[model samples]
Target: MARTKVALVGIGKIALDQHVPAIAASPDWELAATVSRKGTVAGVSAYTDFASFLAERPDVPVVSLCLPPVPRFDYAEAALKAGRHAMLEKPPGATLAEVHTLQALARDRGLTLYATWHSRMAHAVAPAKAWLADRAIRKVHITWREDVRKWHPGQDWVFEPGGMGVFDPGINALSILTEILPDPVHLTRARLEFPANRQTPIAAQLTFSGNVTADFDWRQEGPQTWDIDVDTDAGRLALRMGGNVLEIDGQPMAGENTIMGEYPALYARMAQLVRAGESEVDLSPMVHVADALTLGERVTTVAFDF
Candidate 1:
């Protein structure tokens, strides 16, 4: 079977760290080209502008966009308009309306548009979901804390408007939560802590329906934390290390203990969606983030640098 050609649009940290390696390992995709002003992969065709890439590389039937939320919609819209299948990174777009528009455009053009939630692809997430399928009413608590300096380094765009600040990482927790829980949940209230100099929050406390609550912080300096605990009639269930580890009643369960499996699974799913001529656009996680921004109480914190 021939691998489908794919053009990766953003060659920044994530594209280089995850997307490139995943594509290289996949049996279903070829990294035919990359479009970025300053980032490029060895031996792959590179284009600084998206328009030229679209014009010259019509053979690339699929485009995977890893650009930041703010500018991602334009590129996605252009790719769908050009009659190519498109895949998007987490949080899909800065606004829900734009993603909806892209969905409609993709449907009209008969192209696949996948708004991916990579965290939902973690190794333990499926098992966790299965465990909770027949369980009764319960509660969920998420603690997602990390040092932004360690993860994002000096990327100033993270604190800018549409960058999503803490919600950028927080949404991963929501993605996994939305996937595992048998019942739906919605944001009820939130408190967002913004750095004095930044346009977005540095930390957030969110309350959701079904007794679900989350504490997200980007200021931790030592060991990072990505954990979610669920209490049910069956027992207590927990997902640690960003849904890669699963636990039941404090005893370790069998599952992958690292975050390495997510991207590869995502690429595989994208290939399946393209082959089936289907589009997968789940915005439930992004809906929670949007609700937080719309209804969260604001608190000013110390100015953040880097």
Candidate 2:
């Protein structure tokens, strides 16, 4: 079997920390080239721009886009048109419309396009979904507080209009929520808080209902918490540390795995899609974010200093 030759574009923090390592560890993929302005991966051929990289390495079968959402769609569309499988990091594109466009192009070209949700690959997520399969959900509470300065550091793109701000981490919670919920959910109400100097919201609160009520909050302070609790008729279920750990009724749940292996799992899924000749481009999570933006009330804006 031949390994998929993969190139990476926009090699930034995530590309370095997660995507590159995962690609290196995957047997199905070979890191053939990289495109970035300032950084380069260890031994791979590097280019300052995607066009040059694509032109120079016509044999690379796949391209993983690690760019910020603001400038993602065009590059991804180009890769798909070039007959390469394209993998989007998260929040696929700046707008839902662009993602829809990419999906159509990929489908028409018979290419694999994966808009990956890394959080859904967390260790305990599948188990949680199975545990809740026969149960009824009554309510859900998600507290996803992280110090942006610590996690994102000097990345200013996250605060830009298309950067997604709080939704950057909040979407992970929504991903897990969407997977575990027995039925489809619709947003009922939302509140977005934007810094006076920023275009994106720094914090948000949302309510989702599908025979269950969900509350999602993103804060930038305190203990750096990422937790999701579900109140069900059977018992209260809690997922901590981005679904790497699970608890039920204050007792540790069995069969929980905390491998910190999201990127590796993502590669495996992408390989599966390539072999199966299919695309996994679920836009529900992004749609929920757009719905929050479109329908959520903007209460107030405050000053946010990096």
Residue-level lDDT tens digits of model 1 in 1-306: 999999999999999989999999999999999999999999999999999999999999999999999999999999999999999998899999999999999999999999999899888899999999999858889999999998888889889999999999999999999999998988999999999999999999999989999999999989899999999998999999999999999988957888888999999999999989999999999999999999999999999897
Look at candidate 1 and tell me the lDDT of residue 257: 82
What's the true lDDT of residue 63 in model 1? 99
Residue 7, model 1: lDDT of: 95
For each candidate in turn, the TM-score is 0.99, 0.95
Candidate 2 has what TM-score? 0.95
Question: What does candidate 2's lDDT look like per residue over 1-306, in tens digits?
Answer: 778899999888888889988988889999999988998998889899788777788889899999999799999999988889999999899998999999999999999999999999888888899988889888888888888887788788898989998899888888988898888888888888888888888888887775444344444567667788988899989888888888899787843455459989999999999889999988888888998999899966668777
What lDDT score goes with residue 89 in model 1?
94
lDDT top scorer: 1
- The TM-score between candidate 1 and the true structure equals 0.99
C-alpha local distance difference test of each model: 0.94, 0.86
Which runs in model 2 stand beyond 4 Å of their true positions? 211-219, 254-259
